[model samples]
Target: MAAEPVRIDDPADPRIAGFVSIRERDLTGREGLFIAEGTVVLRMLGQAQARANGFAAEAILLLESRLAGIAEVLAAFPPEVPVYIASQAVFDAIAGFNMHRGVLALGRKPSAQVGASLLGRLPGTSLVLAGCGLSNHDNVGSIFRNAAAFGADAVFLDETSCDPLYRKAIRVSVGSVLTVPFSRAMAGEAMLRGLAEAGFEIWGLSPRGQVSVAAIPPARRIALVLGTEGEGLPEHILASFRTARIPQRPGLDSLNVATASGIALYQIALAMGRVA
Candidate 1:
């Protein structure tokens, strides 16, 4: 059965109530959902249907000009999922930005349990722990994409990290965030203890380090901890974990957190014999 397409010109349409971010309304308690934009992301969403089963998805919103092509893809969805169409101007106004690809979709948020169980399933090797307050969605997305491409087992975020499922993060990750298994650590001391109990050797990435990243010993299980830009890791967390540094030409300040994460993830993967 073909998915129904709904056409709307008004930005105030109630059907898209969740798409609009209202500041006055506190959404902190609301169950979080993921918004994905662009055809690339939509396609990935369709491909990941099995993993995303519990997560409900909104209809694909597209410009009328792109309706026909998008319809072919929407056919993969159940008939109950609507496909919304709007004029380019109306789409831009409703989306609050120039949606160059004229496509957006909302996916149901994964439960914390789903993320927590990931650690038990990972083949003992290396993982990337996002410890910083990565408030930037783009950076969070890029980190997940890199973690997936570099063969990292899982991506773990500290309590202060950004929402990986945010629209910007999903778009930047090209939807790879949906496929990557991740969980949030409770907080400082507990997070460290949980990792230790899990048999993961936590290695903090910082400029002031006793060992170079290249010198990290091959371990059965490893977790690479990354800090936010500018602030870096907290001194307490630094004191808690063994530290490692990336070798660079003197005078260079530091690599962007995402770039540093990619290099570190790749190196760890290689060292653990998980990747070439």
Candidate 2:
């Protein structure tokens, strides 16, 4: 059983300070920490803790009535992790808004690893998701979700890409951002170059791709390159890398980046025997 939760009658209490004014704080950076919301996400936080993968939950805050329902999830964390509970009035006041769901967690981001170092550690047979100039947090999170669902070994984001751990992004991803291992490349092209040098067959996804995703042959190591939703991949990337498209009815501009990622990852993952 999980330890009994501590009651917080004051929104200003220092122990629960990290969770105060959540919406406002989300607009600013979390400074190496992030808020995990909802039961599914909290469960993911618990799982991340279990893996000892460098992520840790510093504390959890719940609406007073939510504790019983989440007792099973709470039990997953170690005894030392504090669980704080508050009434609706106190929780809403602390959050600066109506706090309906009531499930929240403060989790620290893992230590950073350089792109080359992370890629070098991957096994010979691997699949990865590479993002270039992707600015949307939801897209970033969804990419990680697709990566996890399709068994992509890791995700690499260019410096221009948004942080996958952004709260809205994390919630939209259903917690995949916490589960998928990822690294950021300070120079986008340099990251791709390193992957290419590491023997990964990099395929850029574009609307004007020469081959349909279904037609691409399997490879021992592969990386799928994706870009922003409307602009798509850069010309230089398209010109240089082998590119693939998801065949669709003509006339629409393109698929949403998240949708395209799911479809593409599903196809490539199946071809590589990563998915059944």
Local accuracy by lDDT, each model = 0.76, 0.89
Question: Across residues 41-145, which tens digit of lDDT does each residue of candidate 1 receive?
Answer: 887777666456345566667788987777656765667777788998888777776777888776677777877676677775556565666667778989988
* Runs with alpha carbons beyond 4 Å of true place in candidate 1: 21-30
The alpha-carbon lDDT assigned to residue 196 of candidate 2 equals 93
lDDT of 2 by residue, 1-276 (tens): 355799999999999999999899988987889989999999999998899877889999999999989899999999889999999999998888997999999998888753346787798999999999989988888788888899888899889988888898999889998888888756678888888999999999999999999987999999999988889989988887999999998886778989999999999988999888
Query: Residue 209, candidate 2: how far off, in angstroms?
Result: 0.8
Per-model RMSD to reference: 2.7, 1.4
User: For model 2, which pairs clash?
Assistant: none
TM-score, candidate 1, is: 0.88
Clashing pairs in 1: none
Considering every candidate listed, which one attains the maximal TM-score?
A: 2
